[model samples]
Target chain A: MIILNQSKLNPSNIQPSEITSREVFENRRHFLKAAGFGLAAGSALLLSKQSQAAIAPVTFKANSRQKISGFSKTAYGAGEKLTQYEDVTTYNNYYEFGTGKSDPAIQATLFKPRPWTISIEGQVKKAKTISIEDLLKLAPLEERIYRMRCVEAWSMVIPWVGLPLASLVKWAEPTGNAKYIEFISESDPQSMPGVRSPILDWPYTEGLRMDEATNPLTLLAVGLYGEYLPNQNGAPVRLVTPWKYGFKGGKAIVKIRFVEKMPLTTWYKAGPSEYGFYANVNPNVDHPRWTQSSEKPIGAGLFGGRIKTKMFNGYSEQVAHMYTGMDLNRNF
Target chain B: MKKQHIVFVKAAIWLFALLPLARLIWLGVNDNLGANPIEFIEHSTGTWALVFLLITLGMTPIRLLTGQVWQIQLRRVLGLFMFFYACLHIITYVWLDFVFMWDELLIDVAKHPRILVGFAAFLLAIPLAATSNSYMIKRLKTNWKKLHQAVYLIAILAVVHFWMLVKKDLTEPIYYAVVLIVLLGIRVYFKYKPLSKSKVIKAM
Candidate 1:
């Protein structure tokens, strides 16, 4: 009884990669990438060794950099290369100043971010106005170096210095009816040129589900790179959600409201289909204009390759549970 | 124009065309290309390519309206410069930005209408570039004129390519699109105006 076709491996169909065990094949690719990076990093390590100093503060303006003391460090994103201090300060998306990447750095120089007060109102037990100083004292500052993936297919690894939004949430003590948290960014027509135009019905607003607001990864970042946040990089205070796209992290926030309904956000208003409430960094859900599959690392220099983007910007361990049983594609 | 004056104008155009690239190189050396040098390079090159396409398109319209044969003489040079900048732009995307990632590029083009149209514009420009020479022009004859018509499509594709990539702000792409419309509009008006009058004469 000769079998017409035996279950033998067809030599023609077998690829060189298929011949190796899955583990070995995967490891080989990893080893090659690591080898290349090792050679590239050799010079960087040598140069860094000579300094042995803290990474110098780089500001677009002369007096912009101010050190923020007493913030404890964390191992989060410790392995990732920090986007250059200059890039973090200069290249920003604070459309308040202007739409150009460098516009915020240049235009926000004289714009004031001090004497700020965040009004926590809506469905909270009691509405309270917390000043910048008072807000700083609520929780001890900590350094969380999270990978900030922008909605525009770009990313930066920022060492954000701030307290978690959970701290703010706990302080707010929302009512049972409070299902969502809304963030309102400053809309100073006098200072912010962008708000003057009918750009997204200004006084930019962002929102998150009550659960998302209290996530451990959700940060109320006040500073970055060991310095008080640069005016262009959301001075005084801003939201930094590692799992979500950068736009979800509103800048120069002035008000936070506890609402039963989801608040209309600036980006979602600007482009409904492109931007959504759950703007979680899901590589599977593609933004209509830009590909979400991979992102260009800002400080990776000119010839750097775009690294494949991860689910929840690689904070799945901490934040994936929050998005369980949800359709990211539709919500995105 | 005097031979010397014509030569001087050509040289001046050459200097002007090279300025953007020279400035980029200087900026790159000085580490002044800003935070995202790759983005800076990509955008700068793309802008220059669109600018040149308009400049090239403007030549025929200038010749038509002003009846200046000199602009016609300069047309080939301008067209070649447009193609040259376009080549540099695509090189930056393929080499520096995308890094020969064909699989990803294929998937990207499939997903994005902008990428596919932009690539189509670049592909169409290749034949125009190859046949711009005197030898090809002599061989193709009237076919040369037909082949060159793709420039109109290329210009449109290039504008759409730039237009679609913009997130919310379309102020820049609008300028390019408007210029293209005017340039193409003038050609349409000039081509049909005389024919309509001739038809009226026949009716009379």
Candidate 2:
């Protein structure tokens, strides 16, 4: 465990000359108004760097003693430390770069991230855009190792670095009428090969019900494995909802629209019967072709039998209240 | 034909048919088939079975159009190979994917429309393969022709199965559909077309 020196790190050095010159500042403000500052402290994390003023130096946790099935635990700094051996982090699903998991890591290297800004509008009372640089400065990064389960029945435990979605939601300040938040990725077919296919709408879209976004489990993941997320895994930034399937965690997110009703998701739109928008990871809810009772853990032997899936991906304490009396089988 | 030549040719054909089965066994042993090996194995065997089915179906039309009588005999071998691969495919899915989860399998077959179609195709292929042997053919000579009619139904169902499984990539399934359509079209035309007096062969 490495201790951080908060005295040495300052936001004055990291903050860009102007955060509102681009549209991202407006986006954050728009989201704040829509979500309606639920918790003041977390919301403060989303305001300008001047709020804290003093930067907290990052505390590094060496994963030398960590073991995940067949993989070795390595230090993954919140936004800087990453393991990039071609066979590892580079091969993944960062849908903004492409649909194939490995495509984003391989092709997203061509993307210039310095000018990135997100547009937040729709039903929000305060609509404003903000730059990506200012967004990172709002919160100090920390790591959490979470299990990611794909619809295809494979699982991976990733060390994600970012802030909770609640924090951003608080800053966005949801209005009384805002019922859901719709996330959209940039739609540039020339850069994203997966969008070229008619399988899903060109610009991928996902949504979280208003209550879900307020859940602490919802994360605004900026990086993984101690380094900036590889292009294949939603580089720059993405959302990670631990209780849901991987696809529900939209990658390479560009737009955040708070609306009065639930947003239409790409997968659900492509085949409604096959991919339900709720996309909760439930063992009882089987895929059309395959059963969801078990999952083949990634990094395990290819021939190994799958392990049984737990309810709500083992986050029943935090999320079970949301589903309270609903039948997961029917909702699934 | 010389006995040695016949033995060698028979061995070669048997070996050729077993090649895919051997490859599956090798991959299963080495654990190299990837995350969802059951799906991969099931798909590989099912694809090869379709290829063989298409080949067997083509022999009749090809022989009729080209006046090649020798090709008709190979049809039996090709049909049997198709059944052989199909058995491997189904067994893999049942034994590995479902793991003898009969109740769950039943529910799956009931819920998924595509599974029902695939199951129907698999059932139809069974009788056609069972009657391929000389003993079964001789015992049911009059009925053999009627039973073999199931192949046409199986071919159609197989194409439907392929089309439904693919999400967006249609290239491979489209290729199979095209071949099946041509083979099926020729059969239908031959059966229904009117023959002229000059073209009709006189029976001795």
Candidate 3:
């Protein structure tokens, strides 16, 4: 216990200058913006350190990404601390951009997530292409603060702004034969470097059972932190299943299909033995390579302690009933 | 090579070997270790350990292929450096990553094959690191050669441990595996091949 309690010691206090500061993640983007501002606003801003004041501490880069105007905050994970916007945006696993955690932020800079239309096919009644505009209009956007646990034993709290996936399913008008919903991400080799590599089969696919797809807890997130999705974070539109691992949500989705049989997901096909179709965040069921019993909180700084992962990522009340009588360990 | 040149080369290797540790400290000081500092440290130290171990294994191959005896003399220091980083990696995993939770650490070593394999590599390294001194090397005699050969197993375990840890995109680990295979392949080819008198004399 003596050594175990070492986590309680504040590393920052030992060496304030050397320790990882939360301000680093927060101020990194500001410094990038300041550098750009110094160039764009002319050499006057670069006169001295004080000249950085020309760029405010919080200058939202006027990129084309739109902001969601009227998203109402929800009680879901409201008490939890949101991961830093920089960390959430920069540290990602969208393999379409690349394999590295920071690859998407750098590599997806030129990726055009707009002009996107999700194609609905298979057993849907109204099988048609719906633009990003109509997708948002399906329902009022809600700012749902959800805990997303990655299978790699890391987790983040994100304030995702989007409509319930149930609304989109209702809009799709799936036929009675629809048993599972498969989400497909767009794969353009010219923009996405990872698509060129044979990492996972391109056009990354993920699926959810019929009940899970239409659950109120599930979301078709288009924006996060009040802004339209960053290109790296599956911009324009993507799926968000809080109860499952992050990879369960297909990023930058371009198609949704209503199918009878279970849809083969990218992860499921990649490692059939390790990744199961239903990748619910079950702490009891450990991943083949790593443990799921505990997860490191992203943006918790250097001396951060591990947090015990909750069942179904703490959305068990809303999601557990769906898995009733179904063995998640086997399904997982 | 001249005696003074060998000394200079060993000093240079020492400087170069210490850089990765210095870089970790620099990153810690600058807060550049990213969102998860534990992961960054673990990977940096673990990767450096593998890099040093591979280089140590390459020293004997250098002597075998080119008859450069000077290079093999640096193996002891290089092996010691590998042990240093491996120790750091294990400490980070047990203390910082698991917070010295004995049950979790035991479970990690006992349950997960990746952790178990990695732990085995570290345990095997201890005996070799202990015998990396002149006193033990002199006392152990012919047995020293036999005992230190455990590095071959340790190297394979290190690569296998890395191969299993990755979730997807096995590109990085595959490179290390390929290098290890080639290094071992050379020894096997030299050992079993029908030896020409002149070639054998040159290799010796």
Candidate 4:
């Protein structure tokens, strides 16, 4: 189980982890009804390591980090290495934590991310639910510089470390009829404070078309900035798409389903006219009451001049071909 | 001599009113507003607009309660200044958030209910501003009072705009809401009290 050290120390250098398999954590729920069950369960492992005075560090070496061939860092710390809890957990996109830019940072600290698994099903030929560890072992982790464009016209550049969804889906073996892939976030209201908010439907959900999911641009991120994922940024698993609006990247993910038809998405379902399934960051397509032609980099202040938006967040060379001969204005 | 003195005083008040906005523009240019500039600009303009609005709403009450006729003359000026700040608030969102994309801008306003409420408040103020001149007031006559009644609705919406954006920090918005309710309460109490037109004009 993945337990967090609330202190500022690096997970790898922190005290020894009270490691427990998913099987025991999930099955022993009834046993945890007793008093002091948490300390009692973890103390058994803690006593075994007598030499470790403080605690052995929790090491999260998911996979080797490979650099993608051609991508530029964003203006706001895109390619910069993220310090474990400081960078990854501090910056967040959860609006329910409070709409303030720092709401997610303050509220997401309570998230319990251990003992999570992702269920992969739908139109896949070989469908099975895999623990986060199994999914991490499926593909090699690679560092890809992704420019995240929010629907609100603010942008961020993040170097995400994860496997391409195409490689992982290949393992699941998507059926020939599968036309779309939908990702569901873990809906535990007990830990995720945002789930209790009325602003967005609980247990946030997002989806991408089969082609978009398989596109080289899509990544199932396990970490960013050379460390394990932060709780604010989806922790153990989440989706990362370079060409689309940031909302397409579902956070705190737990389920991945392949379907023959387009799946209903949270933003689209909440307000279809405002948020479309194809929320690609196209400067040409304007939001109903705002222009999408430009964006202010996050932390640039509200009145800062906008940086001109690109055709596909400057990823036209890699993704523009998908909309060949079709007018982006119409699709947008 | 008194007329000349009045002109000078009016000019000075106009300059003083413009100063706060000038400082905001300068701060925006220098990027000194702090992290999350959008929030800073939005809050600054929204608060200034509310201040000017409350001041406009207070003109009659201030004049009646304190017998200051000069306060009535400042009403139009304050109302316009409120409109000015509202314009800045809208402009900041258009330039910074929407990047001047009319379609997306329209869609965003449509999608976000809070923005729609704010837009309604701003739009209602526009007609009141346009009809503020003596020529329109004299032309409309009885309709002038009806036309300006929109300000009450605008005031309520302005409060709603403040309330929605403040996710958790209710202190600032709630304070404004209470002040608005009190101001509206005074208007309501006086509204039912029987009075003569000359006495009302003298009080204002």
TM-score of chain B of each: 0.92, 0.88, 0.96, 0.88
lDDT of 1 by residue, A204-301 (tens): 89999999999888899988876678788888799999899999989899999999998999889988988998899988888777889888999677
Worst 10 residues of 2 chain A by lDDT: A63-72
Return whichever of 1 and 2 wins on lDDT.
1
User: Which numbered prediction scores highest in TM-score against the true structure?
Assistant: 3
Off by more than 4 A, model 4: A1-91, A299-304, A325-327, B1-35, B51-204
lDDT of each: 0.81, 0.69, 0.83, 0.71
Docking class of 3: medium
Question: What is the C-alpha DockQ of each candidate?
Answer: 0.50, 0.13, 0.50, 0.22
In model 2, the runs with Cα more than 4 Å from the true position are A1-115, A298-302, A325-331, B1-19, B22-31, B197-204
Residue A120 miss distance in model 2 (angstroms): 2.2
lDDT per residue (tens digit) for residues B19-82 in model 2: 9889988997875564456666888899998988998899888755665555576678888899
**Roughly what TM-score does model 3 have, to 2 decimal places?**
0.87
Which residue window of length 10 is worst by lDDT in model 2 chain B?
A: B195-204
Decide which is better by TM-score, 3 or 4.
3
Q: Which scores better on TM-score, 2 or 3?
A: 3
- The DockQ ranking, best first, is 1, 3, 4, 2
lDDT of 3 at A229: 83
Candidate 4 CAPRI assessment class: incorrect
lDDT of 4 by residue, A78-189 (tens): 4443223333344567654545556676676667556678888888877888977677667655656677887767676666767789988899998888888889887666
True contacts kept of each: 0.71, 0.12, 0.56, 0.33
Q: Per-residue lDDT for B122-170 in model 1, tens only?
A: 9999999999889999999999999999999999999999999888778
Worst 10 residues of 4 chain B by lDDT: B31-40
Sorted into a CAPRI-style docking class, model 2 comes out as incorrect
